[model samples]
Target: MSDFLQQVVIGVQLGSIYALIALGYTMVYGVLRLINFAHGDVFMVGAFVGFYAARALKLEEQPTLAGALITLLPVLLLAMVACAVLGLVIERLAYRPLRRAPRLTALITAIGVSLFLENAGQLLFGADPKFFPSVTPQGAGATLNLGGATISKDQLVLVVAAALLMAVLWYIVQRTRIGRAMRAVSHDADAAALMGINTDTVIAFTFGLGAALAGAGGMLFAALTYAKILPLMGIAIGLKAFVAAVVGGIGSIPGAMLGGLLMGLSESFVRGSGFSRWTEAVAFVLLIGVLLLRPAGLLGRFAPEKV
Candidate 1:
C-alpha cells in the first residue's frame, strides 16, 4: 500500500509537468488546427531562460525561503514572457503566412521551425547540459513521511504550483472575454471573423498563451524534476507531452490534463515494477492503445468532417 501511494505521488508530480506542456498542444490544435511542433523547443527555451535568470539573480547562492520565492517568481515570469514573445514571433513569421495554405504546408513548416530552434539552441546555448539552480532551500534528501510513503518537498511544491497554474488557465479560458473569442475562433474561424472577432488576434493570443504555459512547465521541470537543461532535452519530453495531448483528445483542455496524469502514472508504475527500461516505451504503447480503442481519445468527441 505504501509503495502504491509513493508511486501515486511520483506519478502526479510527473503528470503535472506533462499537463502544462500538453495544454499548449491542445490549445493550438483547437484554434488553428496546426500542431506547433516547435512548442517543445519553446519549452526548452523557457528552461534556458530560467537557468540564465537564476544565475543572473544569483538564486543558487541564497537558499532561504524568502530567497527561493524571490528567485522562483521572477524567473518563472521572465521565462513565460520570453516564450510568449517567441511564440508570437513564430506565428507571425512562420505560421501566419501559411495559414490559408495546405495543412501539410503548415505542418512541414512547424517541423522546420522545430529543427531550426534545436540547431539554434545548440549554437546559442551550447550542446552541453547546464545545472539548474534549486529554488527551495531544502536539500534533495529532505522528505516527509506520510502513510509509510516518503514525499519530497520539491514534489509537493511542484504539484501545488502546477495546480495553481491550471486553475488560472481554467479561469482565463472559461471567464475571460478574449477566451470566448478564442473559443469562437476554434468553432469556426470564418464565422468568428464575420461576427466581428479578429480571428488572427485570437490565433496569435492562443499561441502566446500556450507557449507561456509550456515555458512555465519547462522551468518547473528543470528546477524541480530534472535539475539539468540542454538544447536537445525538449525532444523526448515534448514527444511525450504530444502523446498525452493526443491520448486526452487533443483540443479538449480537461482531456489534456487527464491524459497527462494517466501517462505519468503509467510510466511511474512501470518503473516501480522493475521495468524501468520500458518506461520510455510506455507512452507510445499507451498512445497506440488509445488510438486503436478510441480514435478521438478518452475524453474527445469524434466529429464528422463536412465534404
Candidate 2:
C-alpha cells in the first residue's frame, strides 16, 4: 500500500508536468488542426530563460522562498511572453500561408519550423548545456511523509499548481466569450469567419495560450529534475505529450489533461516495477492500443461531416 501510494504521488507530480505541456499540443490541434512541432522547443527556450535569470540573480547561491519567487516571477513572465510571440510569429509566417494547401503541406511546414527553431536555439543559447539552479528549497524534499510515502514540496507544488491552472483553463474554455469564439472557429473556420468571428485572431491567441502553458511547464520541469536546457529537449517530451493528447482525445481540452495524467502514471508504474527501460515504449503502446480500440479517442466523439 505504501509503495503504491508513493508511485501514485510521484506519477501525479510528473503527470502534472506532462499535462501542462500536453495543453500546447491539443490547443494548437483544436484551433488550427496543425501540430505545432516547434512547441517543444518553445518549452526549451523557456527553460533557458529561467536558467539565465536564476544565474544572473544568483538564486542558487542565496536561496530563500521570497528570493526564489521574486527571481522567478519576472523570468517566467518574460519567458511566457516571448514564447507567445514566437508562437504567433510561427503561425503567421509559416502556417497561415499554407492554410489552403494540403494537410501534408502544413505538416511538413511544421516539421521545418521545428528544425529551424532547434538549430537557431543551439546557435543562440549555445550547443553546450546550461545548468538550472535549484528552486526547490533544501529539506523541502523531506517535508512531508505519510504512511511511509514521502511527498516532496516540489511534488506538492507541481500538483497543486497544475490543478489550479487546469481549473482556470476549464473556466475560460467553458464560460468565457473568447472561448466560445475559439470553439466556433475550431468547429468551422470558414463558417465562424462568415459569422463575424475573427478566426485568424482566435487561432493566434490559441497558439499564444498553448505556448505560454508549455513555457511554464518547461520552467517547472527544470526546477524539478532538469538543470540543463538543450534545444532538442522538447522533442521527446513534446512527442510524448502529443501521444497523451491523442490518447485522451485530440482537440478535447479536458481530455488532454486526463490523458497526460494517465500517461505519466502509467510510465511511473512501469518504472517503479523495475521496467524502467520500457517507459518510452509504454506510452506508444498505449497510444496504439487506444487508437485501435477507439479511433476517436477516449473522450472524443465522432462528428457528422457536412455534405
Candidate 3:
C-alpha cells in the first residue's frame, strides 16, 4: 500500500506538469480547431527563458527562501510573457495567412514552424544539454512525509503552483468577459463576429494564454523533474501531453486535466513496476485503446454538423 501510495504521489506530480501543457493544447484546439504542433517548441523556449532569467537575477548565488521567491516569480512571469508573444507571432505570421488555405496546408505550416523553432534553438543554445540552475534555498529541498508517502519539496511546490495557475485559468474562462468571447468564438466564429466580438483578438488571446501556460509548465518541468534542457526535449513531452489532451477529449477543459492525471498515473505505475523502458509506449497504447472504445475521447461528445 505504501509503495502504491508513493507511485501515486509521483504520478500526481508528473500529472501537474502534463496538465499544464495539455490545457494549452485543448484551448488552442477549441478556439482554432487546429493543433499548434509548434507549441512544444514554445515550451522549449520558456525553459530557456527561465534559465536565463534565473541566471541573470543571480538566483544561483542568493539561495534563500525569500530570494528564491524573488527569483522564481519574476522568471516565471517573464517566461510566460515571452512565450505569449511568441504565440502571437506564430499565429500572425505562420498561421494567419494560411487560415483560408486547405487544412493540410496549415498543418504543414505548423510542422514547418515547429522544425524552425527546434533548429533555431539548437543553433542558439547548441545541441548539448544544459543543466538548469537550482533555485532552492540552502539545504531546503527535504522530503515531507504524508500518509505514508514521501513528497519532495520540489513536487509539492510544483503541484501547488500548477493548481494555482489552473484556478486562475478557470476563473478567466468562467467569469471574465474575454472568457465568454472566447467561448462564443469557439462555438461559432462567424456568429461571434456577427455578435460584435473580435474573433481575431479572442483567438490571439487564446493562443497567448495557452502559450503562457505552456511556458510555466516548461519552467516547472525543468526545475522540478528534469534539469537537462536540450533543443529537442519538448518533442517527447509534447507528444505525451498531446496524447493527454486527446484522451481527455480534445477541446474539453476538464477532460484535459483528467487525461493528464490518468496518463501520469499510468506511466508512474508502469515505471514503478520496473517497466521503465515502456513508459513512452504506454501513452500511445492508451490513446489507441481510448479511441477504439470511445472515438470521441473519455470526456468528449460527438457533435454532428448542423448543415
Output the number of the TM-score-best candidate: 1
Query: What's the distance in Å from true for residue 208, model 2?
Result: 0.4
Top-lDDT candidate index = 1
Clashing pairs in 2: none
Residues 17-45, candidate 1: write the lDDT tens digits. 88999999999999998888999999999
Model 2: per-residue Cα lDDT over 104-166, one tens digit each:
899999999999989998888888877777765766433588898887766776687678878
Query: lDDT tens digits, residues 1-307, model 3?
Result: 8889999999998898888889998998888888889988888999988887777776673455556666688889999999999999999999889877977898889899999999999999999997667776535445778788888777888898999999999999989999999999888888999999998899899999999999999888777664698899889888888999999999888888999898899999999999999998887899999999988889987767546
TM-score of each: 0.96, 0.94, 0.96
Clash counts for all predictions:
0, 0, 0
lDDT of each: 0.90, 0.82, 0.87
Worst 10 contiguous positions by lDDT, candidate 3? 61-70
Candidate ranking under lDDT, highest first, comes to: 1, 3, 2
188 in model 2: Cα distance from truth in Å? 1.8
lDDT of 2 at 212: 81
